[model samples]
Target chain A: METKNDGPKQEQRLTKKGKETRARIVAAAAKLMFERGVAGTTVEDVQREAKVSASQLYHYFQEKRELVHAVILFQTAQVLSAQEPLLSHLDSIDALWSWRDAIVSLQVERQCRGGCPIGSLASELADSEPVARAELASGFMKWELAIRGGLIAMHERGQLRGDAEPERLALALLTALQGGLLLTQVHRETSPLEVVLDAMLAHIGSFAQS
Target chain B: METKNDGPKQEQRLTKKGKETRARIVAAAAKLMFERGVAGTTVEDVQREAKVSASQLYHYFQEKRELVHAVILFQTAQVLSAQEPLLSHLDSIDALWSWRDAIVSLQVERQCRGGCPIGSLASELADSEPVARAELASGFMKWELAIRGGLIAMHERGQLRGDAEPERLALALLTALQGGLLLTQVHRETSPLEVVLDAMLAHIGSFAQS
Candidate 1:
């Protein structure tokens, strides 16, 4: 999704300390940005939240847009890392269901306060900020690829019918998840999400080898 | 979806001239808000864009939040109005596909520039703006109910299997459309929308009794 130059070039060649400091700024920005939108969150807020000096914040990020880019990447990695266990093992229908249950439980734990971090950014910035939009799009592609990989695995394991198109199915599954999360965030209830996921999974099951 | 009071009443009691002026403000605000998010769009921007004086803008809205509420309602009406012809006639499977094609064509016509008007607002304001979130939630509910109505018609006609749950299926269809719209907005491509809708519609067809 990120099409612009990585911006301020030092990200690729940071020293150990520099990397840690940069990561700290990004983590803090991600949290604040998630709670408040990009337009609402300021660089001063990120500096205070990260507890880094102004110079330190500037050292890593030349501008707020650059910092936003890092945060997008950070959120993407965080989301993927959280689901790695279930996503990597989605070689069977049951495994996929487990993944759905886990997602629902996690939402309950959060009291359904925040929607998908990456998705929230995509919604806010995708159209207005070209560079950030590219990064957000790439983040989604990564997520889609992960789901597609699992579906492909299911196909290879003979869990799904030979005619089942893993790419389209995975895309549909992700779409359901994204839509479900959006509704869940709005309603502060998990039922919308559950209904959508159930339907998506049921569709997936229809393709299960009989 | 909207659980809050509509706030600062009298949206229903405007004179013809008052109604036209208010509608102009709402339309201008919606366009600006869609292009630049809520936080990014200021009262001054709305006044300038709407070609109304500041006092005139305030006379109608009282605050930016009130304007946002109106815009939310305006967008809901705009979206529903556009789909009324197709959405109202979703009594057959072919009608639904025609609806999908019409949607895809509209997206291509816009060069996939803007996503769903209501969804765009929801993504930006749902978490931070409680009133707007409630309004957005209500907008989604209205959209969902419309879809559900059509599905119920199908079920009554015995087009779908006895086990088909219109409520859940309508929710799922709406979810797919929302997710598809979000992705389509980000990628600036119609494929994501097409893929997800095709998959969702196919799933619905699975519940069709031969």
Candidate 2:
């Protein structure tokens, strides 16, 4: 047998094909969860959708709930990672407008499917399940922190007015985003999201250095 | 036997005691629902907690699902009716500020449990159940319309800027309110809501005649 490596071997041991299989399983689980809601989705459904054997799926994840938690974390990171670049760099109101556009486009592209994935999950179970709730809370907290850091940077760089309340600004931005997302989901259209995003940008852009 | 009105006849017609009992039952459902969530609550739990017999509860509500729908409407109306007088008479920025303080205190007094009862429920099961979902949608639509109408009147009266998009502004305000509610639920505090509301007032107040 080949010698075991000192590292996790997650990348090396799993063949390129096996890695693809694992990703496919996760994507399949995510799609199913999106359709059925977290509580309704079962491991068997994921396995069937992924076309993977029960043993193989179990080999990848020990328990169904654990796998769901993994899926949640996976999706949470995916959403947060998407905003990394836009949220990480914002030195001025113009930058905020550009970032807001990216956010609106991301939300609009999805056609508001069942609302924000993380918010939807949070509302679904609220704090019913400890692990899921923690994951959900962590996801939102992480997203909020990213925005807060961006605002702080902008404020420190003198791009934002010296009196701007960074924390309150971030909170307002988040609430506007959430409001846009919920309205979009309810109407199953992008108009509401677009309007809210535009108004938000207009409101924020009023502070531009012009 | 005395002539009866319908299902369960009372000693006269809805005595003060009877009305209080009904209100208590609805309040009990709302509290349990906000805590354990709607999906986790059952009629049996409501009956036990409300200390009302199944037959007595049925007299007030046809079934568990119907009871939830009634709760949704009652909660929606409760929220809207409370704001109606204030919003309806809102003709100046100072009045709006007073309204904001009242809202903040209302939410803080209840320990942040006084969320937009309709929004919380709509966020969860609005897409899951058709009938209940429609009822919730209608409830929200009515509440938003009321605000939109109020803003339109204000704009027409020159209290607000003529360019004010009353309808869109109203929707955005509702969305922000819901977002504030979500944050309040997460933080278990009203400060988040207060700050957001204050920021909202700042935004909206900018357009009001000084």
Candidate 3:
């Protein structure tokens, strides 16, 4: 659990308008990277999409790697925020199922076009970019902890079996999710996501107090 | 379940030497793609690594997409074949655990450098290349069928509970593996794969007959 404070330090020095410009640039980069991938999207593409000049983009991000790091943090927050109250309150089996339904429905609505934003980043940059990989790993750790929080609450409440390990269960659920999304994205169908999440939830349910 | 006859038809017409040359080019492409990614590796890189003339490379693969398709098939076969009799015979829980050990050990031996070859490809190319996505999906389907074959055998033999669905269980196992591998690759550790797979096996074990 090594925590690295890799957030862009330059953001602290920016004025209100400068911070707005930086946020806009990161959002533009995130969108393009989501659609065209990190390698496929260029600095020029971000500049053009954000309506910012090269100097402005560079001022916010020293290079593409810095921008990609910003995008990872942006996506991490975006994804977890989107999961919201559901992710924060997985203390019961019913709540977990509801969370699963929310996730699957969102994928179906999007037609499974983009897999997990953090996951796609991990797949592409894990090996080649060590710094980015660490950031992505940290992002996943945060996600796992969020899932673990609910399971731990259930365990503490005596809702889960005494032998049930919340940390392991949380990791399993996240793994199933990442795998399901990958398959769903590849097949362009929601069945894989549905099947995997259902399976994980069923496994979690098995530990519920009868 | 639409099967596309997308294999290079011209490969069938090649002489032994021509086929060897084609394979050499493909093996090189697969290596580069695995190491550098589909976008990072260029046709020229493959030509240089394979030590084949551009004309000969083109003779086998008319485009990068075709080459990526070949790599998908290559890695699929390579991965599945490496699993051997274990993948083909998952009749009992012991057998299944043994298969899990084999997979986990391989990841450890490789230091988890390359995630799943087919998985990484699917992550990178699934959305961008529809044809490759279909082929990668087919590869996953084949892998799933192999896993299902064992569970189905167990069900037929009364080793599993009557309510256990082999297809769903198999897909769940695959999903866990894919997710585990992705996380393990990002973290550069085998614990994620081990934890997720162990949870999946525990779930499957719940259906085991006494």
Candidate 4:
């Protein structure tokens, strides 16, 4: 139920070219943070990777914390957008399985390298960075809502049992995905992701109308 | 499937007093790393926290990577030992629910503040540190096996359907747990963890013997 109201708001004032420069910095920072984590990725490193001078980087982000906020927004948008229409219409068991397949395939493609971008941020900042934690929380809320949309549609169509709670079910699916990705990333294998998603989808199937 | 053969091996040669000093250093390092993350916690912080001189700290650990490996082992042992007999005896639905309750209660007691100790380390180190990743993967494998022990016992007793694979089920439970804890930590609530565990347990119950 946590809402996302606060994000890096400097973009509204930037010209088109300025926006591009800012976004390029965020992209580089995201990639580095995803690989090395927040504490390991420094402002100087972001500057080096983004090919921007100290003045240019500081013009957009006053500190690494601000840059981190931008990265959270960037990664959240990327992850949610990647799911696209599939996440919006999880109305059937088959549709859910398709979503599962898409997730597993992506992890397999990456050879289980980086864990969930938002999740990695959450793990690193949840204890120390209150602002980052809120932003990440909002990102998860948005994701949970996207997932809930599908289950809500299924429930409305009477494809699911009366006891099936769409909100809870959607949250469970997202939770499984996070855990699966973490395990898969550590094990450098796809089975953890595959197994957890399959288990969640199977749980959903158990609620199907018969 | 990962094995835990490699841990900080310096303890084997230490006398009782040496072992205590080494353990004190690891405990301090684990506490700092748990709060500030692996990259954020430096050797100086650990030495200061443990009240040890630099020479003494160097005598025990050659570098921070060795210290991290020690922290991983310490956390893994702490987590598994805390689970105790419950993790060893998750043979029935009621027993599983009890285990779930214990986990939730601990999270709530902590006010949902530090995410799983092992999970936080895995998130920060899994990608950057291969040795630490293997240590974490081994920890998860051991935890999975403990959960599997109960499920396998139930399966052999015909308490579950023939189709139920204990290994997969145990992995699912642990996966759900990691995801739920991550969400709960970010949102500072207990529902995500509660819902995921309940869903997974319900899924397990669906395989109950008629």
* Candidate 2 interface RMSD value: 2.5
What TM-scores does chain A show, candidate by candidate in order? Answer: 0.94, 0.81, 0.96, 0.96
lDDT of candidate 4 over A98-135, digit per residue (tens): 88999888888888989899999999999899989988
Q: Model 2 reaches what TM-score against the true structure?
A: 0.77
Candidate 1 structure quality by residue, lDDT tens digits, A141-180: 8899989998998898888999999998888888879888
TM-score of chain B of each: 0.94, 0.80, 0.96, 0.96
TM-score of chain A of 1: 0.94
True-vs-predicted CA distance for residue B35, candidate 2, Å = 3.4
Per-residue lDDT of model 3, residues B2-121, tens digit only: 434555566788899998998998899999999888988999999999999999888788898888888988899998999998999988999999999999999989998889999999
The parts of candidate 2 lying over 4 Å away from their true place are A1-29, A42-68, A106-108, A127-134, B1-32, B42-68, B82-85
Candidate 2 C-alpha lDDT tens digits along B1-210: 111122134324687888777777777887677666676678888888899998878777777676676577677778888875776665566766777777777877777653567767777665666566667667777767876776787788887887778787777767777777766665557766676666666777667873
lDDT, candidate 4, at B200:
93
* Model 2 DockQ vs. reference: 0.32
Tell me how each candidate scores on DockQ against the true complex: 0.71, 0.32, 0.81, 0.89
Where is model 1 more than 4 Å wrong at Cα? A1-9, B1-9
